[model samples]
Target: MKLTPIGPAALVLALSAATLSACGGGGGGGGAGGTDAPADYVDGATFTLGLSSDPGNLDPLMGAGSALFAVTQFAYDPLVSVDGKTGEIGSQLATDWTVDDTTVSLTLADDITCADGADLTATDVADSLNFVADPENQSPFLGTFLPVGAKAKGDDATGTVTLTLASPSPFVLNGLGSLPIVCPSGMDDRSSLAKATSGTGPYELTEAAPGDHYTYTLREGYTWGPGGAGTDQKGLPAQVVVKVVENETTAANLLLSGGLNAAQIAGPDGDRLEKSGLSAAETTGLVGEQWYNHADGRVTSDPDVRMALTQALDLSELADVVTSGRGGPATTLAVNEPVACPGDSVSGALPAHDPDAAASLLDAAGWQEGGDGVRTKDGQRLEVTFLYQNNLGSSGDAAAELAVQQWKAIGVDATAKSQNETTLTGTIFGAGDWDVAWVSLNVGSPDQLVPFLSGPAAPDGTNFSAIDDDDYQAGVDQAMGMTGTDSCDTWLDAEALLVQKADIVPFANNTVRTFAKDAEFETPGQLVPLSIRMVAK
Candidate 1:
C-alpha cells in the first residue's frame, strides 16, 4: 500500500518523484491559510493533538500505516526533506547532494547530533541505508524507498555518504526524504525502536503510553529540521502530546472544549468543526479504494471476476456517499501533494457502473445465480471477505456496507469486515485471509508503488493482492528507464493499465482536513510537527 495520510483506505498507486516534478512540481501550496507565522508566541508551551487511531508500531521499516509514519517524522530526521509547497528538495540531515548517473552522493551535515547526545556520523547514516537496502531484513521500505542492491558507503573524514544504485532510480531523493534515519542504538536493537526514540530530529520521545498517547520534548540547540526549521522558531511548542481518541464526536467535542489543540476529522464532525470557526488544513488524498486479492485461492483471482466486480457499482454515487458529499471523483492514484503524475487516470480506465454487464460477465465466467440470488460454481458460493479499516470515520463504514449490498445485488456475497489498522496490516501482510480490502496506500511517487503492483505477494512482499500483470510491468519498465518529467506519459499509461485491468479500484478523492484550535501547523499530507505551535488559550 502506498504511504499516505491516515484515512479511509483507497485503492490507488503512487507517482514517481520524477513524474511528480514533471506533472506540476510538488503540490505543496497553502491550504486553509492558518499556517502563517503567529503574531503572538509562547515558548516552552505544550500542544496536544487528537488522533483517531494508535500508530501501531513506531518502527518506520516495519510499520505500514500513515499514522505510524506521521509519528516517526517527529522523532527521526530524514537524510533529505522535500518542500511541500514548492516541491523543491531541501536539506535535512544532509547538507548537500549530487546525483551522477545512477549514484547519489550526499554530504552529511557535520554538526547534527542524535537525541541521545551522540554525534551523528556518516557511518551511522550508511549503516541505516545499507540495512534497509538488504531485502533479507524484510523491511517494507526495501525496494519501495531504498533501491534494491543499492550500496551505501560513508567516509567519516569528510562526512560523506555515497549511495551506489544497482539500477536507475529517478526519485532517489524523494524516497530518501520519506525514509526516516535511525540512530545506531535504534538500529542495533530494532525491537527498542517500536517504543523508544533516537535521532537528529527536533523532538525526543519523552513518554510512551502506547495506545493512549505519546509525549515528545523539544531538544535544545537542535537546528536540523525539514526546510531548515530551528528550535528557536517563534511559537514552536516545547512539548507535543499526541492523544489517541478514536471517536470523531469525542474528538470534535474536545476541539470545541479546547481540550485538544488539533484533530483530523471528516464527514459530519468535520463539517461541524469547520463551521465553528476552527482553522482546518485540508489535504487531498484518495479514499474508498477497492483492492481484490489476486491470490490463487481467492475468487477475485479470476480476471473476469475482477472486471465484473468493478462494473457492479456506481463509483460516482459511491464517492459521494463515502465522503459524505465532501469529495470528488478520483483522478489519480497519486493523490498526495507533490503528486508526480497528476492526471485523470480514473476516467476512461475504470469500468463504468453496469449491473447488467456485471451479471452477464459473471454468467459468462460460469457462475450461475442460485435461488437466493447468490452465485455458485462447483458447489462453492461466490463469497469474498471485504476488509476495511474501522478508524476511517462513519462514511467509510457506510461505503463498505453499500459496496457489500451492491455486490450482493450482482450475486457476489461480499462480507464487510471492519478491522483496526494493526489487525488489517497483520492480516494483509501476515495471514493473507482477506479477498478484497479497502486500504488507501498513497505514496508521493509511482516508483514507490512498484512493490505493491508487481513484486512478490504478502508473507514475502507487499503485493498483498498478488497482482502480476505483464502489460503493466512492461509500461513500468519503459517509464523507469526515462528520467524526470520525461517519464510522465509512460507513468500515466502504466497507471491506466492497472485501472483498466481492474487490478485496483480508486473510487473517491477527498480533501481531508485537520481542525486546529489554539494551534497552528502545516498539514501538507500529515501534521508537520516542526511547524506546530501553541497559540494563546
Candidate 2:
C-alpha cells in the first residue's frame, strides 16, 4: 500500500507542540447503523469513496497517489497478489511462480480475460513486463516494481511467462506482486490508459473525469481476486465511485450525510469522526522525509553541507510538527505492507540534531558565518531551497517552515516552498532547480528504493537524489542473493548506510487512518476496492 503524503502545521500556522486534543464534540449519530446495516443494502449498489486528492492519471505505472494505486487494483491484476497485512503471496493472473537465482518463472491463469473481452495471454503479460523494464519507457517503476534491464519471454502454448533478470533481485516476488499487468491494447496505446483501463481484474473503468470522480463497474466472473475474492461475493458494490473531496471537513460531513461510504481522514477531523462512533483502519508509514539534492551546482551537492543541514534540526520536534504530534519515529523505508523488510533503520542510524556540530561542520568546510549569521563560501551564500508537496496538508507546510528557520539558526539560508505532487515531481526530477526536498516515497522493499537512491538522475531514472553510495550498492548486491525474511538484515544494513551518510532523513511515521461510513473495507494504505462491502442502507 502506498501512503498519501502527510506533514504538520495545523490548518493554521501555529507552531504549538501540543499533542492533539480530543474532538470538539460527538458527531450526528450512533455510527452509520451500529453492528447491523440497513436492510436495503444490496450487492449491486454503488459504493462512493471520498478521496483527499485526485488520482490525476489512471495509469498504474505512472500514478503515485495512494488512491490511484487502490483504484488500479479494481481494474488490473498482478501476476501474484500479496496479503496486505501478512507477507503471504496469493494467486491472481498467475496461479503459481518460482524463482531460481536470476530466473523467475510464472504460470499464467488461462481463464483470465481483459476488459475488452480479449484473452489475457502470457505473451501480453511478458509485453507488459518488458514495457516497464525498458528504460526507454521511463516508468517510475523501472527499478521499483520491476528491475530495469530485466527481460520477459512468454510461451503461448504452455501458458508460462519467464522473467530473466540482469541481476539477482532480493524481493522479486514482492515486486511482481505489486506490478499491474496491462493488456496488449493498453500497452500499445499509452495515452488511452490515462482515461481507461484494460486488464483482468474485478472491475472495469466505466467512466473517468480526471480530477473529479471515477466510476468502475464490476466485471462478471472475476474469480481471480486477491485471496480469491470474486465479483459474485455477497454485498460487493457493483459500481464504485471514487470522488475527489480535498477538504477533510467536507469529507467528514459527507460521511455523516451518507453521501460517501468511506474516506481516509487524518488529523483533528479524524478525531471528531472517531468520537462519532466511526471506526477507522490505521496504516503506519513514513510521511516526513528529507532528501538532499546531489545534482551539480546545488549547494547540497557538498557532503559536509548536506550533513550540516541535516544535523541542524531537532528531528523529534520536526516529526512532532509534521505529524501534529500524532506520529512516531520513522524506522524504515519499507513502510508499506506486506513489508519486504522489517527492521528499525532510524533509531540509532540517523544523525541526531546538533546545531553546534552543524555550525562547526560548516566552519570546517570553509563556510564562514557572514554579517547576517548566514554562511558564505567562495562568495556564495550557504543557501538551499526546500521543496515539498502542498497536499501533505498544513502540518507539512508548518514543518517545512520550521526546518527553514532551523537551518537559518545554523547560518544556512533555506527557502521553503510547497507544490502540488505533479509540480513537486517535475521540480525534483525535471526542473532540477531544487537544493533539498521533503518527499516521502513509501515502497515495500529496500530494493524498491535502489533506482531512486542510486543510479542515473531522473528523466532517465528515479534516482532524483543522485546518490552514488558504494556501501549501499554492495549491501543491495549481497541482499539480492537472499530471499524473503532472510534478506531483511542486509536490506536494513544498506538503508542504514544511506541514512548514515545523510543522503536522506526519514523522521516521522504516522498511523494514517481511513474512516468507513456504511461500507466495510480493509486499508493497508488505501481502501481495497474488492474488499469493500456496502452495508445494508
Candidate 3:
C-alpha cells in the first residue's frame, strides 16, 4: 500500500496520508445546524463533500494518494469492512472468512454485482488480489496490505477465494478491509479506470470534471454494504459530489452555505465551524510526522546527524504550531482510532529538545560550524532540503518555517519546501530527491507499515527512506508470529526502536474533524458508503 499523504482527510495505506484524512472518525450522525437535535433525514438528496485536492486516478490498484483513495471508496468494495468504533470485522463483498496462520479463506456474497451490471464472482476478486500481489505489477500495496508472495485461488462454483500467505500475517483480515476489489472489466482494460470506475460498490462515477468535481450516482438494489447493510434506507443520498476545493476557508464557507454536505477543516477555520454547530465525524490521526532519507550520500544517512536534527527542534512547540494548538503529542504511528495495536510507543522514546546537545552531536560528527554559522564537514557545507505537504494550510507552513529556523540556529542550513500531495508522493516514492519530509502513512494495522519501513528502497520498493533497523526488523519478525492484539506489545516495542533510533519522528496527533452540513456519515479513514444519510438543511 502506498503511503497516504497527510492532508485535510487522513490517509490509510489501507488509506494513504492524503486519503486517510478523509477516512478517519467512527460512525456518527451529522450534528444539528445550530440546534440541540440533528436535522431530520431526507430522501434522494444530493450530497456534496469537499476534498482538499482532486483524486487524479480512478483505478483502484494503480493510484496512490488520499484523493484517489477517498474517491475510489465510492466505486470499490473491499472484501470486508472494519467497524470504525469497535475495530470489529464486518462483511462486504465477502460474507464470511476464516484465517489460520498464513492461510485465509473467504466466502463471497452471491448477489454482489459491478457498476456495469456484471455479476462479481470469486474469480474477479482473486484476480484483483493477484494483480496487486504480483511484484511485476509494482503495486504500492504489494507487500504492505497484501503480504509479499501471497497467492489467491478462486472457485466460482463454491463462491470461495482461498489465499496462501508467504508468511504468518497478524492483521491480515484488517488489511483486506481496505483493499478495494476491482471488477473484471476494469481489470481487463485497466486504462479504462483512469477517469472512470468499475467496481462492486454502492456508488458509480457518472461525472468527472477534474480539479472541480467528480460525481457518483447511487446504485439501486445495492444491498451488500458494510455489515450487510443495504441502500434502501430512507435517507440515502441519490448522488455524491466530491468537490475539489483546496482552500479550507472556502470549503467551510461552502459547508455553511449548504453548498457542501461535508468538508474536513484542519486549520483555524475549524474553530468557527465548531461554533456553527455543524455535525462532525471525528478521528484522531498522526498529522505531524517527520522522516529522513537514510540512503547513501544523504546528510541524514549518518545516525548522529539524524539525531542532532531531531534534537534541534522543540517538538512540543512544533506539534502545537503544526496543529494550530488543536492536537496533542503523538503516542503512536498508528493513530487511526480503533487501531490494531493501541499503545504509546512515541511519548518518551524520542530524543528531547536540546540545541546544545544537537550542536555537540554535529561537532562530534566532524561538522564544524564556520564563521558564517553554517556547519561544514570535509569541505562540504551541511545544507539540508526539507519538504512538507501543502495541504496542511498556513499552520503547516508556519511549522515548516519554524523548523527551518530551529535547524539554522543549530548551525545547519535547512530550507523548507512545500509540495502538494501528488508531487510530494512522486518526489518521495519515485524520484527520491528529498532529504527530509513531513509525511504520515496512516493504517490501522502495524503489519501494514512493514513494507514501507524496512523493504527495498523506492523505485525498488516502498521503503522510501531506506530505513535499515535490525532491532525493528527483529521485532517485526517476532510480532508477525503472534496473531491480533496478542502481538501489540511486540509491535509497540518495534515502533519504539524506530523512534529511539530517530528513523522516524511522529510528533503530533490531532482529532481530524470532517464537518457535515446536511449529511451525516462515518469515515473510518474513508467515508463508509452505507453510513451516508442525506438530511434536511
TM-score of each: 0.93, 0.90, 0.94
- Model 3, TM vs. native: 0.94
**Sliding window of 10 residues with minimal summed lDDT for model 2:** 9-18
lDDT of 2 by residue, 1-537 (tens): 243444211000000111111111122222221344335445678988876656666787765445567577788888987776676788878888998988999998768888898998889999999888887767777777787679999999999999999888777888787788998889889899988998887889999987789999988988777756567766678899988877767888888778888776655677778788777666676777788888778888899999998899889998887777888889997676566778898777899889999999999999999999888999999888888766556677788888998999989888888875545666666747889887777676777777777888866666777888899989888987776678889889888988988988888887776676766666553445666666654
| Candidate 2 segments exceeding 4 Å error | 1-3, 7-41, 65-67
The runs of at least 3 residues in candidate 1 whose Cα sits more than 4 Å from the true structure, single-residue gaps closed, are 1-39
Query: Residues 1-537, candidate 3, lDDT per residue (tens digit)?
Result: 324435422233223222221211122344322223234667788989887777776677765577787888888899998877788888989999999878899999877889999999888889999999998887777766688899999999999999999888888888898788999999999999899999988899999998899999999888888867777776778999999887778888988888888877777787887787765666677888899999999999999999999999999999999889988898987766567888899987988999999999999999998999999999999998899887677888899999999999989999889876766777777846788898877777788788778978877877878999999999999998887899999999999999998999989887777787756666777767677766665
What lDDT does candidate 3 reach at residue 238?
92
Q: Candidate 2 vs candidate 3: which has greater lDDT?
A: 3
TM-score pick, better of 1 and 2: 1
How many residue pairs clash in each candidate at the backbone level? Answer: 16, 8, 28
Regions of candidate 3 where Cα sits further than 4 Å from its true position: 1-39
Candidate 1 residue-wise lDDT, 1-537, digit = tens = 344334421111221111111000111232222345445545778888887667776776676666676677788888988877666899989989998878899998768888998898999999999988887787778767787779999999999999999778877888888778888888889998888887778889999998899999988888877656678776778888988887778998998898888776766788877677776767677766788899888899999999998899889988998788988888877667777666787788988999999999999999999999899999999998988776567888888888888999999988888776666777877747888887778776777778778888888877777899999899888877788667877877888889998999988888777777776677555567777666655
Indicate which candidate wins on lDDT. 3
Put the candidates in lDDT order, highest first: 3, 1, 2
Model 1 worst lDDT window (10 residues)? 15-24
Q: Cα lDDT of all candidates, in order?
A: 0.76, 0.74, 0.80
